[model samples]
Structure formats: C-alpha cells, structure tokens
Target chain A: MEMKSFLIIGMGSFGHHLCRSLAENECEIMVVDKDSEAVEDVLPLGVSGRVGDCTNIDVLRSFSIDLFDACFVCMGTNFKNSLQIASFLKELGAKKVYAKADEDIQAKFLKRNGADVVIYPEKNVAEQIAIAASSDNIFDCIPFVEDYYIAEIRPMERWLGRTVVDVNFRARYNLNIVAVKQGENVIPIPGPNYVFNEDEHIMVLGHINDIRRVAY
Target chain B: MEMKSFLIIGMGSFGHHLCRSLAENECEIMVVDKDSEAVEDVLPLGVSGRVGDCTNIDVLRSFSIDLFDACFVCMGTNFKNSLQIASFLKELGAKKVYAKADEDIQAKFLKRNGADVVIYPEKNVAEQIAIAASSDNIFDCIPFVEDYYIAEIRPMERWLGRTVVDVNFRARYNLNIVAVKQGENVIPIPGPNYVFNEDEHIMVLGHINDIRRVAY
Candidate 1:
C-alpha cells in the first residue's frame, strides 16, 4: 500500500496517539498545535510540525492543508474551536476531515458542520470496556457494527474438551471462532479441529445476541 | 444474568458514559466525583451518587467500596491521582480495578499500581478511526486482537453482484461476514445466497492482512 499523508491539528492525547500509529505505519504526518512543547515532542517521531491556532483559516492555508489526504481535529475540550477547524478544513478542500468530541451532541454538531467522521473517544472506549466487564467470560468487546461483535471470550464449562467443529458453533449458536488467543499470542484462522481449553481465550465473531449466549 | 454492582470513581466523559451504559443494562451504580455538577448530570440515569476524592482512602472507606464487583477510575488528565485511586480501590478489596490512561507509559503505571485493565480511550479510538480512513471500502475497523480485525466494508467492484457462496469468502479470503448493514437496518447472520449491493456495508472478521486484501 502507498503511504498516506495526514494533517493532525492539536497535540492532545487523541492526536498524539494517531500520529504515533500513523508514523509506525510509515505515513507522512504534518502536525499543528498551539502548544510549541507538544509539537516539539512529536518532531523526533518523524512528523513535520507547526505551532498555530487551528480555528484560523489562514493558519490552515499556510500549511497547504489541501495537500494532505486526511486531517484530524483533536481538540477534545474545545468544542467551538474544533467545529470551526472542521469547517475550515472542508473549505480548504481537504479530502477527509475527522474530529474528536467529548459527547454525543458535539459529535452531531461536528458531523453537521463538515467532519467526515465525528469520533467520541470516551464513549467508544467506555461502551466497549463496559460491555466486556459486564459479560462473565468476555475479556474485551469490539463492535464490528450494531448487530455483530468481535469478542475475546473464554471457553465455557459446557464447551470444554470439545473441538470447534464438535460444538456445532455456527449452526447451533450462530457464532464462529476465528482465532485462539493463547496467553499473549494470537493464532488466527484456527482449524475446526482445534480443541477448546480452560486457559485459552477464543476470539469469535457473531451477532451480539448469539455472542452473549455463549459468552455468559 | 444477575444484577452487578459498579462503583465509578470519577464522573468525566468516560465514567459518565460507562455509568449510563451500566444503568441501562440494569446494573446498580454508585458514582463519585469531586465536582458535584459532573455527578449531578448522571443522577437521572439511575445511579447513586457521592461527592469526594477517590484518591483518599478514607473517602472510599466511607462508601464501603469492597462490596462492589468492580470499580472504574475515569479521572482524565490526572495520572497520579488516578493511579492512587486505583491502588486504594484494590487495597480496600475491590475485585477488579479499571482505569483510563492517556498514553502507553501511564497504562503501564496504572497496571502496576492495581489497575487490572488500563484502557487508552484516545489510542483505541484513533487506531480504529485511522484504519477506517486509510482503506477505501472500510467504513469502520475494530481490532479483535493485535492481528485480527473486524471491519465494516463495502463490496469492491470485483465483489459486486456476487453471492456469498459464489465468492467463497470463507475459503478464498479467509474471512466471514457476520452481518449486513443496509441503510439503518442490520441483518445478522445473513443468508448464504444473499446478493451483494453497492450501498450496503458488510461486516467481516479476519486477520488484518486478509482484511486489507479485501479492503482495498
């Protein structure tokens, strides 16, 4: 795959982590923030840097933001500034603009203003983590969509000493195991003959309802 | 499932959302925050409340915190205080301690200090959103583990008009579709003969490599 170019506006936690992940993937990143210290800290991480207020259209124009494939406005605490920044990014002809919000209402506002995607980091994490904690054997819950979930679930007492095929998981429970997580290692596309064990974690995909039936 | 009790240490965005989810799931909730206003907002969501610093062991003792099944520390931007609170919760005999961290270093620190699970809301959301933005067909990406991903993807030109059995997605691509999201409706465990439409998003589970093979 070709490298992606990203313009990250703000050096908050969301922007910082995004830059780090994109850098690890060999993407070219240009980061802007009002805090000089924040921009300086990320400079050594192979990202180009600038220090300026993101709400100003002139600052975005000076950076030639239109050249980037996507831009992220991660001003978590500043709703007004983030909205203005999102609108300005769209006006600058950026291909895609994503913004971070503290709550659901703010997400709707960002989406209405011009953000291609409005993200709520806190809500997303809380929902995933909360769902995981609620279930007895689910170590984590990742939503593929509203109906389907990718979950790390331990083998139930009834499922012990059984192979994946023996359980008739797909037909009986409307679920399928894609991988086995042994300790910290992930074994993907495990064979149907793979046996279930007490200590291992199985990663499965299914309707959230079917997942709960086996997970609990 | 029987009723589960949760004690939320801080009423920030993450805690507030988690509390709301737990309440909606019919769990008993006890929420505490130094800022009374933050606590007040979540009161209508069917949660009991207290106003105090969870970092102080005495404040926690007053609440009889050991009775709760789990506790969540959502004190954003206060690493030291959050870590201190996690330690206090464990010391008081809380079964599990979950914490929110802004960075990897903080996650390590929280884990060492009594947090059984350290969640990085920003990093988790950023990584998912970035992967979604990078791929043309991927509407969303959820990591099941380090190697496996569950992604909502639109069918590419090669996949258009093909039936599930015809494409042999499971055998050829090492992937399986769990659901089909058409407009606002979700069709879970979609039939094998279901036809692919350009407007619908199919949620599939596979290793990251396989997801990318189909994503682009």
Candidate 2:
C-alpha cells in the first residue's frame, strides 16, 4: 500500500477532527493555521504543523502546495478564509482540494474557487438525524441514493423467528438485509437460514417508500 | 404517515439544519434559543420559534415539553447549557431527547444527563472525509456497520462493459452493489443483466478490508 500525503489548512473544530482521522489512516499530513495554539494542539497526532496564515500566497507557496496528494481547507464558519485558501491552493497547483462549507451558497463559491469537493458536516448529520427522528421503527438511517436509505430498523413482528429464506425478504419486501446486529456484534451477509430475532436490529437497503411500508 | 412533533432548543448551526430537515420531512417543529436573531432566522421555515433560555426550568416548562414526540438540545460548545436542558427535558417527561456533542467526554455526560442519543456531526463528517481522502477510488463513503462502509466508488477498469452476472460481483468480491449511479440518477437494486459502464459509479456494501483489496 502506498502512503498518501495531505496538506490541511486551518485548525478549527472541523480541521482538528480531520487531522485526527487522517492521522489514524496513517497518512503523511502537514497541518497549517494562523493561531500558534491551534498548531500546537494537533502536535500529538505525529504530524508536522506550521503556524502561518494560508491565505497569504507566499505562506501557501512555502509549503509546496502542489506536491501534496490532496489539500484540505477547513475553516469553520469563515467562508471568506476558506475561499481564499482554496483558490490559493489551486493557483499554487494543488492536486485535489476539499473545502468545508456551511450551506449551498458557500459550497458553490468554494467549488467555483477550485475546490474538488465541499464537505457539509452539519447538514449531512442533521438530515441523517431527521430521518431517524421521524420514524419510530428506525434506530438510525443514512441516505444511500435518491429516495433509498440504509436504515438500521427493528424487525417486523411477523418476521420474528422466521428465517431469511422463509420470508423471501428481497422478493416480498423489496429490501436487502445487509447485516444483522446482535448485541455488540454485526453479522454481515448472514446465510439464508438466519432467523430474525426480537432483540436484534437489521440493517437493510431499500427505497424509503418500501421501508416505510414494512417498518410500520 | 403520522406527523412527528419536535422541540429543538439552541439555534446554532446544527439546530438550524435540524429544523430545516424536520420541516422538509413535514414534521411539526418548535425552535428555541437565547438569541432573538437566531430565533428569527428560522421563522421562514414555517415553524414556530421562541427566544428564551432553555437552561432555566421556568422557561422550559412554558413550552409544555412533554407534548413533543422528541426534543433536541443543540447548544454548540455550551456543554453546560445542553446538559441542563437535556436533564430538564427528561424530567419534564419528554418522550425522547437527542443532544449534540463535539467529543466523547461531552457525549458521555450528555447521555448520563438524560439525552437518549448524542450526535457527533463534526467527528462523523471528518472521519468520512478522511476515508475518501485516503483512498483514490472512493468518491464518498459512510460507515454502515462494524468495519463496513457503504462506499460510492469508481468501477475497476476491468469491470467496464461487463454485465453484473458476467462478473459474479458478490461471489467474486464479497461486495454487494446496492445501486448504480448513472449521471444524476441512481438505479437501486439493479437487475442481474445490468451492464457496468465506464461513466457510472457503483455504490457497494462491504468490509474495509475487502473494499481496500478490490478498489485498487
């Protein structure tokens, strides 16, 4: 496996988290921020840090922005700073730039400024939570594609004690049981003989219309 | 579908997003915050809003907290206020309570203080971006179950022009192609005879180890 390298600009809550996650992935990372304290906070992650404002072309250039595999501009709530840094990184020839945005307007501007992708952390989480909150049977749900959702849901009362083959789940409900959660463990791609239990939660893939019909 | 009712306290970024999402879900929502400007910001969503300090039990009681199907405490960085509101909501007999936290310690305290669920929006999004950044083939991914991810990935060069049955995807890769992304549309649960094209992205469900092996 090849070790990827990354340059992350900013050290706000989102930036700090991105740094930690990249470190866990064992990627070679260089973090930058104007605040000396912010730079110091991520030192324990075993990554290099520079206490300098990335909005300055010279400061951004000094890091050889083009050399990193990808660059991330993570300024929380500061659309101006994020845009400036993202544009500078692209101007300096950074390969792939990811920028954080709070909403659609910021996301559009960031993309226009040369961001390869815009991450909407709060919006995504909120949507996921909203789906879970709207339904009593769904424990958690993440948007899969279009109207489809990958939902962790309680088994229907009729499904209890019935084997997967016996229920013909895919044909009858138009849903795929991807995994079964029993206590602390998740059994992925269970065999056809696997029986639905009252205490277990099943992770299934299906359209929202179908899921709602069966879930209730 | 039954209309769900929500009481969201604290009009921060997450709170606003949640309110917007719940409104889209057609749920009855009531928003609250100490800042009148924050309260005014969400009035356009067709939901009721109140500017009051929820940490004060008297102000919280005025809302008839027990009437809502669920309550959300969404104070950004104000752990004290969130804990106070969460505890007060549970005491007021709110059916369910969800609270937002930035880290594990805050999450633990919120859970202990009567929050039925704790959300880590920043952490979840950061981890998701980290995975995408670390891999060259994965466009986006979300954690599905233990060590498993539902990833939108570029199809391998060799798989182009092959039918789903021709490749025997599930048996060969131990990965399930849940959906096919063709342009802006996603075809969910594609038929066995569906052909793989170079321009399309496939959303697959599999373990990290299996994904890593095949994605490259």
Each prediction's DockQ against the real complex = 0.49, 0.57
Worst 10 residues of 2 chain B by lDDT: B183-192
Clashes of each: 0, 0
lDDT of candidate 2 over B27-67, digit per residue (tens): 99999999999999999999999989888899989988889
Where model 2 places Cα greater than 4 Å from the true spot, the runs are A157-174, A189-200, B154-177, B180-202
lDDT of 1 by residue, A140-188 (tens): 7877656566789988888899987898877887777767889988776
Q: Give the true-contact fraction for every prediction, in order.
A: 0.58, 0.66
**Best by TM-score, which number?**
2
Query: What is the DockQ score of candidate 2, to 2 decimals?
Result: 0.57
> Which one is best on DockQ?
2
Which runs of model 1 end up more than 4 angstroms from their true locations? Answer: A161-168, A185-200, B152-216
- Give the Å error, residue B23, model 2: 1.2
Best-fitting candidate, scored by lDDT:
2
Please estimate how well model 1 matches the true structure, expressed as its whole-model Cα lDDT: 0.84
- Residue B44 of model 1 has an lDDT of 94
